[model samples]
Structures are given as structure tokens and as C-alpha cells.
Target: MPETLLVLLAGLAAGALNAVGGGGTFVALPALVAAGQSPVTANASSTIALVPGAVAGAWVYRRELAPVGPASTKSLTAVSVLGGGLGAALVLALPSESFDAAVPWLLAFATVLFAFGGRLSGALRGTLDRPLAPGPRTVLVMQFVLAVYGGYFGGGVGIMMLAVWSVGLGIDSATGNPMRIAQLAAIYVSATALFLAISDARSSPLVLTTMVAGAVAGGFGGAHLARRLPARLLRAVVLSTAVTMTVLYFLRG
Candidate 1:
């Protein structure tokens, strides 16, 4: 009962965070691990569980979605879908030992990105003589790379997307947020389809269902709350959660 409750709460929090900014994986993955799932299974299950929430969040922001620099929405989504599927295949192909060892490091890397992504984007923007406006091809390629990573271990990928757009296309967080949510939905949609078809994520059916329900509710509520809440507060909440989870994962390792 307690384990189920933990996952439910975690999913709710994670979905809300993703809707507001990103970093849902930081919450969902560790909670599933603590619920006695193996690292690889937990990762896959987390991805599966977060899909509905991400889609819900994306739907909320559909009206605000925009092209990423020169890349049209359709083109960017295509690359994200393709890259996400490939990354999911890689995860399924790798041995479990590698995934177990990689979890802590991935969490740490994501925490660092969450902490410094804004600063890094600003620094890059300031250092450059002009906005780094790459062609559609270049933007699509970079997005594909990020999408692959997102499929594998999506912790701070949304922030990375914002950073790329901010520096390369001069898009601010406010302007880029809707598209970030949309791309994240695309990545997760592809990954979830793959995971459901072949992964062990379905082993914990009760837990998965519980988390999915909570995530769906949270995603919708969070989207509404995001309009009223302050962005700084949202970022602070996400950063603190990311830091805490990273520290715990490192200690566990």
C-alpha cells in the first residue's frame, strides 16, 4: 500500500514538474527504483507511465507551439520520433548491468544540466557575436541527438532544448516552453510505444496504472497552475527536487 502511494505521489509531482518546466524522470525513475524495480525496468516503466502526462501537457500548450528556429514543428517532431525509437532500441539491446551502473551518473549529469542550463544558455548567447541561427538541417540534427538522449535517460532534456533554442535561435523560455512540452511528448510517445511492445515495464501493472492515473491528473492540473504560478518558484522547486534525487542516487550507488 505504501509503495503504491509513493509511486502515485511521485507521479503526480513528476507530471506537474514536467508540465511546468521539465525533470519528471528525476522524480518518477527514482521512486520506481525505491519501489523495488531494477534500474532498467524502472527506467522503462517510468517512461511508460509519464507518457500520458506529457501528452496532456502538450495538448494544453498546443496553441502556443512554434517552429524551433528554422525547423518546422512537423520536421522536428519527426526527427524526435525517429531518434526516440532508435534510443529505445538501444536501451532494450544493452545488458542490464550497464544500465544499473549508468543510473547514478545519468542522474548526476541531469542534475548538473538542471542547475546550469539557464546560465550556460545565457553565457553562450553573451559570448557569441550574434544569435547562433543555424539552418533547419543543423537544428534538426541537434534536436535528433537530444531526442536520442531523451529516449535513453530523459532527465533534463527539456531544459537542454530550451538552451539550444535560446542560444541558437534567440528563443526565450516563455517562447520555447510550449514546443519543449510538445517535443517531449513526441519523444515519450515513441519510446513508450517501443517499451510497451517489448520492455518489462508492464510487469508492475498495478503500480503502472496508479502512476499513470496520477500523472494524467497532475499534468492537466499543472498546466492550469502554470499559468498562475511564478516561473522562478517553479524552477526552484524543480531544481531542489533534482538535487535531492541526484544526491540520493549517488549515495545508493
Candidate 2:
């Protein structure tokens, strides 16, 4: 019962995070793992449960959905679906040990990226005299890779997307957020489809159902709340949750 409650709370918080900024996966994945799931299965199940939250949040911003850089909405969505499915397939193909050992490292890497991604991406483009925004093709390629990563483990995909848009395309994070949510939904939809067919995502029905319910509520509520909250406050809440979760995972490792 206690474990069930924890999963519910995690899902609610994760859904809110995804709606407001990004970092829901960081919260959901760890809680599911702690509820006696294997790392791989927890990752898979978390993806499955969070799909509705992503969709709900995306729907709230439907009217505001816009293209990133030179890429059109349809094109970006296509790449996201394809890359996400491919990443999900890779998870089923690889051995669980590979994921277990890599989990800490992955979390740590995501933590660093979320913490300093803006500066890091800026530094990379710092040498360019023109500092041009990424073109359509460039945006597509980057979206595909990030989608693949999202399908694989998610974690900080939202933050990563914001960084890419903020730095590579000179788009403000606020403007890019709606697109981020939409892309995340696309990735999760594809990944969840794969998980439903081939993974143990449905093995734990109670956990799955509760998390989904919580996520739905949180996602809808958070979307409405996002309008009132400042962007910096939203990012700070996400970053704080992300940093704390990453540290705990490393300590466990």
C-alpha cells in the first residue's frame, strides 16, 4: 500500500514536471525501480505509464504548437515516431545488465546536461562568426537523435530539447516548450506502442494504472498552472528534482 502510494505521488509529480518544464522521467523511473522493478522493466513501464501525461499536456498546447527553426511540425513528428520506435526496439534487444550499469552514468550525464546545457551548447557555437540557426535538415537530424534517446530512457529529454532549441536555433525556451511537449508525446506514443507488444510494461498492472491515473490528473492540472507560473520557477523546480534524483541514483550505484 505504501509502495503504491509512492508510485502515485511520483507519477503526479512527474506529470506536473513534464507539463511545466521537463524531468518527469527522472522522477517516475526512479520511483518505479524502487517499487521492486528491474531497471530495464522500470524504464519500460515508466514510458508506458507516462504516455497519457504527455498527450494530455500536448493537447493543452495544441493551438500554440509551432515548428522549431526551419522544420515543419509534420516532418519533426515523423522523425520522432520513427526514431522513438527504433530506440524502443534497441531496449528490448540489449541485455538488462548493460542498462543497469549504465543507468547511473546516464543519469549523471543527463544531470550535467540539464545543469549546464545552455552554456555548453553556446560554447560549441561560440567559435562561429555567423552563429546561424540550425537549418531544416539539421533540426530534423537532431530531433531524431533526441527522440531515440527519449524512447530509450527519457529522463531529461525535455531539458535536452529546450537546450537544443535555445542554443542551436536561438529560440527562446518559453517558445520552444510547447514544441518540446508535443515531440515528447510523439516519442512516448511510439515507444509505448513497442513496449505494449514486446516488453514487460504491462506486467505490473496496479503500478501502471495508478501511475497513469495520477499522471493524467497532474498533466491536466499542471498545464493550466503553467500559464500562471514563471518559466524560471518551473525550470528551477524541475532542475531541483532532477539533480536530487540523479545524485541519489549515483549514490546507490
> Could you say which candidate leads in TM-score?
2
lDDT of 1: 0.81
| lDDT, candidates in the order shown | 0.81, 0.82
Worst-scoring 10-residue span by lDDT in model 2: 95-104
What lDDT score is found at residue 113 in candidate 1?
Answer: 60
TM-score of 2: 0.89
Candidate No. with top lDDT: 2
Q: What digit string (tens of lDDT, one per residue) describes model 2 on residues 30-91?
A: 88998988888889888888889989989998998888989999999999999899889988
Tens-place lDDT digits, model 1, residues 113-164: 6567667766776788555669999999999988987888776677667656
Clashing pairs in 1: none
